[model samples]
Target: MDIKGTGAIVTGGASGLGGATAALLAGRGAKVTIFDLNADLGNQLAKEIGGHFIKLDVTDADAVEAALQEAEGLHGKARILVNCAGIGPPAKVIGRDGKATPLADFTKVIAINLIGSFNVLSKFAARIHDAGTIGGEEGGVIINTASVAAYDGQIGQAAYAASKGGIVGMTLPIARELARYGIRVATIAPGLFLTPLLMSLPQEAQDSLGRQAPFPSRLGRPEEFARMVAAIIDNPMLNGETIRLDGAIRLAPK
Candidate 1:
């Protein structure tokens, strides 16, 4: 999709991958609305990019609907929706501590990583459906974020892996269903990116992880992921698939 003048909404747009995507889209002339719980950063980004910011909790259906309405008021209906809001709190199903991972912790990951994505995507799509087509197309496009862990989760990532796995599994069917409406769905399964979470590790540990990459032998940049997102949006044929942005590396068992 040509981003110029198009309305785009990015969840988790305050930081990390979502923030990069939002900035890139804005730079490409898209009218952007950042939907995130981080009011401070979201508001700052909105100001920086001349876009709107809506404090949103993706898991709350009613709040999401309201936020979408607010965004529409600012920049029509969204033609691009990006789901980048997720959490990865690692925990073994049965830890060495001899205690099972708490159900609430596991559930929290599912709620934010899986259900939250669905919540925002569904509400945004519904709103787009009501608004009809854009750019001579039937509707809009949605890009969801997954992780390599979904396919090769290490020992301490059971809940995180399952949640991301669900996202990867649903991409194709969701795209197929939305295709008739010209609404495409695609997913990005990123490997060790140099985001705040990963960068916080000690330099040696980060270097160790980077060395695991097969060729480039380094961590990914958020901009690289944003570039891929732009490609997916521009190439109409790319749909219903999860593309790995990893640098030719399958993770090791932890």
Candidate 2:
């Protein structure tokens, strides 16, 4: 559980929360590997952190396996895996145009956000299981990213909410299954965070969103999320649970 010198893999490490987690883990002396589709940013971040970067699409099983091998080659088998690669494209099931949301788009969201997470987690867990235990633990810890939308989704978030809800729903069972191997599973259901996707909105829109928070009245920071991740890694008893990183904000139906 000690992060110092531990091997860690972070999916979607090119930017946003994943990038922040990578930097924090590196700062804590963990040997980090970044798995992302953004080759340029991934490579740069790997260089900056003195770690490894694998250009990978988490949804591709073959690519995920190959990337895991590459990461193991660099830092041995990873003891910490963080699933942060996800997409949130907002659309109503039935829009004002009276057209139903495209089924393909909804499926894509689930593919990337839910199935993609499983792909990386399964690959990493297999490697860890094969390599055996570290520090008396059969494996390492896994942190998955969910969203507050999973609990209280605003309008036009059907796809995103379903995907994230799947993540939240999977936590307990996965943790129970991994316990024999000493692999902990946890999830973070984040509130409104100022990720690139949110930043692209008009400033006024951004301000309005921030004002909705119950406390501090602002978007969560990536570093704040990173801090929670570090805490989860260090605390052995924290397992099989989803922690909401929202500032006590129950979103209204938009």
Candidate 3:
């Protein structure tokens, strides 16, 4: 899965993990297309990195199809697909007020995080499959983003955890199925990272969260995650698995 001189598609490529990945691949000579809901950031990043940007909403099937068509038109059919389009608004199943959370909250999380990833991955893979084998040995690779919370969610994270859990649960099965097509599938379960969402917290709060990690206690760098993505793309044997990109941190119950 050499990235140089190939086509790659990264969902949610406007910011955070996906943005880092897009930059990494583009830097390595891949023709990257960013599929993101934020046209402003996506367009800015595209120009900055010399990649293309397509406004996309991963949860919409028709929009996904159309966006991929446009992306492939610009970059050719993508041999790399990274699913990083997700949302995590945490809520407790039972609040301290004694009322259970609204069912809509759970559904929204599932829709955007779980089903959204699948929607983009499946559509992108299908498009690339139709285009045929890419470089030499492999047709394509798919890297999905999960979270540490999938395994050890804290309080007020039932919806978020369940959504991520579905991603972890499906990685191996999807990999097995896609193996025949010379396509590899893997997921990354990141620990506490200083993504924009977390960085918005107070400085002390951020430090406190970082200190929770067992050793070398600090938030993860986006470049670090990008490098792991490159490693997975480079190694054909690293399929059907989810790699945890976190520090040695198991979250508390909270």
lDDT of 2 at 162: 95
Off by over 4 Å in 3: none
Please write out the lDDT profile of model 3 over residues 1-254, one tens digit for every residue: 88998899999899988899999999999999999999999999999999999998889999999988887788778888888888888788888899999999899989989999999889877876655665666889999999999999999999899999999999999899888888999999999887889989999999999999887698888888889999999999999999988888999999
Query: Which 10 consecutive residues of model 2 have the lowest summed lDDT?
Result: 129-138
| Candidate 2 lDDT by residue in tens digits, 1-254 | 99999999999998999999999999999999999999999999889989889888899999999888888888888899999999887898997889988899999999999999998998888878656667776478999999999999989899999999999999999999989889999999999998988989998998899989989798889999999999999999999999999989999999
- What ordering of candidates by lDDT runs from best to worst? 2, 1, 3
Best by lDDT: 2
- lDDT (CA) per prediction: 0.91, 0.92, 0.90
Candidate 2: stretches off by over 4 Å: none
Model 1 — which ten-residue stretch has the worst lDDT? Answer: 129-138
- The TM-scores, one per candidate, come to 0.97, 0.96, 0.97
State, as a TM-score between 0 and 1, how close model 3 is to the true structure.
0.97
- List the candidate 1 regions with Cα displacement exceeding 4 Å: none
Query: What shift in Å separates residue 113 of candidate 3 from its native position after superposition?
Result: 0.6
Q: What's the lDDT for residue 132 in model 2?
A: 66
